[model samples]
Target: MKAVGVIVEYNPFHNGHKYHLDETKRKTNPDCTIAVMSGNFLQRGEPALVSKWARTKMALEAGIDLVIELPYAFATQKAENFANGAISLLSALHCEEVCFGSENGTIDDFTSTVSFMKKNQQAYDHTTRQYLKEGYSYPKSASLAYSSLANHDTYVDLSKPNNILGYHYVKAIHDQKSSLKAETIMRTSAGYHDERFSHESIASATSIRKALFSAERDIKEIQNYLPQSTTKWLSAYFEEYKLFHRWEEYFTLLKYKLLTSSPSELANIYEAEEGIENRLLAFISESTSFQDFMEKIKTKRYTWTRLQRLCVHILTNTTKDQLKKINENPVATYIRLLGMSQKGQRFLNHVKKDVEIPILSKATGFSDDLFTLDQKAAQTYLAIFPEPLRTQLLRQEYAKPPIRFNEEQQIYL
Candidate 1:
């Protein structure tokens, strides 16, 4: 069967995602579509609003045939590594095409940008490093470096959020030397970081999340911006967990980690370097919340996303040595199945033997370090919840099998 793949967070599936999925189907026309989604923690260095399984349910209900977990190692990484993990999974799934939502919808522009960068790689590296040394944030340095190279040339703009991610996707495809064709769908209406709703029917997941966390706003106010499947699962999560996740929930623990750990030990955590440990230590007592802590910690040199990622590492206790080993040999060891539709099950059964990598449907008997790290991530996400619920959910995560959606029955199994 022909297959197409999308890299997604689905944080909670919403109308904009529905639009992209529709357009991907319209464009690719694959027999089965798959999503390699982030697990409990996401690329932006934050906990997902709900569990990955709930989000997977959202994906399956929205017509995605298969949903796989992008391993925590990659899902919680920066742009390049994030793209690497997502593309590797799609390749492992034997997908023929990979599509992403981007500010620049034209695939050729991304290809052109990739080709130009490859040709001038040495110069690009030099410029990026020099700018980094001069105190520019990584993303800013990249944009400035690209401008210096593409001086008079028209290419994909590296400044826009989606476009930058799209460029990384294309670059990963070429870097991995995979045959999967890359495609893009132009992002509509809401922007990636917009904290407020922009359209009546479509909104960025960020905006939807902001509303969900607002004191005055509630889930019902944002119902129109999500699919029924999204609304249903979100309500279900609230009903069961009695809370939705936000950074503020983890603030106290973060403060404890920083204040308690020695500066030397803090430096061992991935992304906690260059004396950031000291700054984090200095602010721990004075900071009132995660927002306040981040405001105090953030500078032109350190982006909010970067700092949050560092916090995630601290929360999970993931070390630089651990991550460095993985980065050096960054092949996806296995693809963990989160959930699947009937079609997805069939597709997997058909392709499992021919696929190059292991397809992990359950983690009960397994013992891979990467998977263990993912397990740690899930536990950390659930750690904030009280007593029996936390214990129950953690048990359920390992003991349960990959979710199966019965199209005919119109129910989850």
Candidate 2:
């Protein structure tokens, strides 16, 4: 069976995502559509608005034949590591193609950019280092370095959020020297970080989230931007949880983690670099909220997103030593299915005998550090909720099977 893979974090599965998924299928037209989705936490270091299962239901219903979790080791990483994990998984699964949405939709430019960077690798590294020394944030420094290398023509604007991620995806494809063909589709309506709705039906997830968490708190305002499944699942999660997952919800927990650990201890946390632990110690005490804490801690070197990612590491008690060991292999060790449709199940059965890696349906019995970290991520995410609800959801981490979507029966079985 021909399989096409997508790397996603359907935080809530807005219309923009559906557009990308539809466009990817149209472009690839593979027999099986597989998605490697982030679980509980996301790439930006923010928790999902709902749980992974809720988002998995959204994907399975939307059009993806199969959904698998991107292990926490990869899901919460920077762009390069994130792409490395997702692309490696697709390659390991024997996918024929991998598609992603990007501001620079054309695949050739990304290919060219990778090749260009490789050719100017030393010079690019030096320039990036120079910018970093001068206190430019990593993203800005990278973009400036790319422009410096291009001189007159920067083919793939390394500046845009999607473009940067897309570049990394292409780079991973080539870096790993995988056989999977790469493709891209131009972003249609919304930008990645737009904080307010500007389109009728297509809005950035950020904007949709902004609306949902706004003072007005109008869920209906963003409903048009979501598929019915996403709407239903999101509403249900909110109703039961009584609040969406946001940094603020975990602020008290994070504060405890921050204050209790000594500066030397904080130095061991992943992404807690350059004496930033001391800075965090100095500012965290006076800060009133997550936003306030972040503002006080922000510097030219650490972007808000970067800082948030660091917070995720701190919140999860992920250490530099622990992550180093897990990433020694780099690629994920197994494929953990989150959900599957009838087509997906058949595709898996056909491919199972030939698959190189283990395909896990149940969460129990995995003793690997990667799997342990994934379970820990889910447990940490649940910690935000109160007793009964938290315990109920936590049980699923060990006992729940991959969700089954019966097309003929028209229900999850």
Candidate 3:
């Protein structure tokens, strides 16, 4: 069976995500749709508003045929690593195509940019270094360098969240030279960082999250744009647990880890480079809040988001060695099933014999690699939430309902 893959956080299933899913099917008409999703943490260095299982159920109900966890190590990383991890998973799953939402919807433009970067490596490198020396953040430096070389201001807009992510996705596909085809759907309505909601059919996940968490919107109102199963799962889940509030609950443990671990040990954490270990130590000593610690350590060379991810890596014990090894063998080796429908189950059966990666349905206490790391992170991540919420997360998997799509539901575009 032909399968198309999507790399998503879903953070909460909203109309925009539904549109992407529909568009992917319309373009590719793959028999199965697979999603490699972030676990409990997201790429932006924040805890997911809902648990991964809940998000997974939401995806399954909305249209995704299968959901695989993007290990916490990659989920809480910068765009390059995040794209690498997600693309690796799709490639491993033997997906034939990948469809993503982009501000610049044309694949030709993305491929052109990729080709330019590949062929002008030296100019890109020199310009990047010069920009950095002039006190720009790495992302801004790279964007400026690329724009200068291409004579196209488009690359400079990489500061925008979706555009930057799309650029990385294109880069990863080009770097890997994979057979999988890449496609994009035009972004509509709400922008990625926009804190407000739009009246259009497509709504940003940010707006959805805000609405779900605020008293201004009721659950029933939010339900209008989400799949029924998502509404069901979230309604049940929210009743039991409050979403994450402050970042300080994890700060004590993070400080303890930073203080207790040797500088040599800190050197091993992902993104730890060129005496960053000492800088982290200094920040840990003086800074109290998570935001303060990030501000104290942030430099022109490093973005605040990137530094936040590094802190998460340290907190999660994702070492530089681990990052390097994973990069070397980037293919995802396992599928940690979050949720699936009956059709999805049948699709799973068809692919089971030929799948390169081991498929995990139950979170057995046995694995020791990335899967184990994911489980540990999920357990520890829950501790930051309030009382019964923590308890609910610990016990969620045992009682959480799986998503089941109706047979009569429209599958074709």
Candidate 4:
């Protein structure tokens, strides 16, 4: 059976996500669509607005045949690593094609950028190091380097979120020489960072999330931007959990982690490079909130998102040594099934005998170092939610099976 793959983080499945799914199927006409999604934590280094299970349910309901978990190690990294890991999983699963939404350019445009970067790899590296030496953040340094080395206006487009990820997605396919074909669906509506709604049905996830968390906007208004299934899901979740979580909710725990940790200890946490720990330590006593602490630590060399991710590493007690070990063995070790439809189950059965990675239906007998970190991520997610719900989610991962739906059972969570 032909299968197409998508890398996603449906923080809460919005209408735009549904559109993308439909478009991918319409364009590819694959027998099945597989989505490898971030769990609990996201690439932006923040907790998802809802749980992974909730988002998995959303994906399955939205028309994805299967939803697999992108391990925590990959899910929370920079764009290149994130795309590399996702593409690797798709390759491992034997997907024939991969599709992603691109805001800046067509597939050929993204592919050309990739080719340019590859051709000028050495120059790009040298220029990036120069920028880094001048104390710019890695992302900024890379963006500036690409612009200079390519000597073209379009190269600057690499700085945008969708373009950067799209570049890396195609780059990974090229570097690995994988057989998976690449495709892009032009972004139709709300831009990535847009904080307010334009067309309700096509609003960005960022905007939808902002509206969900804001006290001023009526939560009922959120129903407009999301699909009926997502609307029902979110409403049910909101009623039970009281409120969806945000990274700010973990600030107290993060502050405690920083205060209790020594400067030396902080330096050893993942991403705490070159005396950043000392800077973070200095603000431990003075900053009262996550925003305040992040602002105090922010510099030309560290973006807010980077600092927040560092904070996550600190909270999760992920260390430099631990990450080094994981990075050394970067190939995905297992396939985590988050949810599936009836077609998805059949697809899984067909692929099971040939798949290289272990297909795990539940978190049982799995003890890889990376899988352990994934468990830690879920636990971290649980800690942020209220009591009964946290316990419920924890149980759901181990005991409940992958969500399955069919014609008779329209939706099951």
What would the per-residue lDDT of candidate 1 be over residues 257-328, giving only the tens digit for each residue? 788899999999999878988998888899999999999989999999999999999999999998998888
How do the residues 1-413 of candidate 4 rate in per-residue lDDT, one tens digit apiece? 99999999998888888888999999999988999999878888889887777787778878888999999998988888888889989999899999998786478888888878778889889999999999999999988987776745555287778888988899989988899999999888888888888884789888888888788875677887888878877777778787787878898888788888888888888999889899988887898877788888899999988988888888888888877887775668888888888888888889888998888888877788888888888788788767787888887776666777662377563
lDDT of model 4 at residue 41?
Answer: 87
Q: Which ten contiguous residues of candidate 1 have the minimum total lDDT?
A: 150-159
lDDT of 4 at 405: 69
| lDDT (Cα atoms) of all candidates against the true structure | 0.90, 0.89, 0.76, 0.84
* lDDT of candidate 3 over 74-116, digit per residue (tens): 7877788889888877877678899888887777777877777
Instruction: Please give the RMSD of candidate 1 to the true structure.
Output: 1.2
Per model, how many backbone clashes are there?
0, 0, 1, 0
Please give the range of 10 consecutive residues that has the lowest summed lDDT in model 3.
404-413
Instruction: Give me the displacement of residue 367 in model 1, in angstroms.
Output: 1.7
Over the stretch 101-177, how does candidate 2's per-residue lDDT look in tens digits? 99888898888888888899999999999999999998889889988878435478888888888989889888788
The order by descending lDDT is: 1, 2, 4, 3
Judging by lDDT against the true structure, name the best candidate.
1
Q: Residue 279: error of model 4 in Å?
A: 1.6
* Rank order (by TM-score, best first): 1, 2, 4, 3
C-alpha positional error of residue 125 in candidate 2 after TM-score superposition, expressed in Å: 0.4
| RMSD in Å for all candidates | 1.2, 1.3, 3.9, 1.8
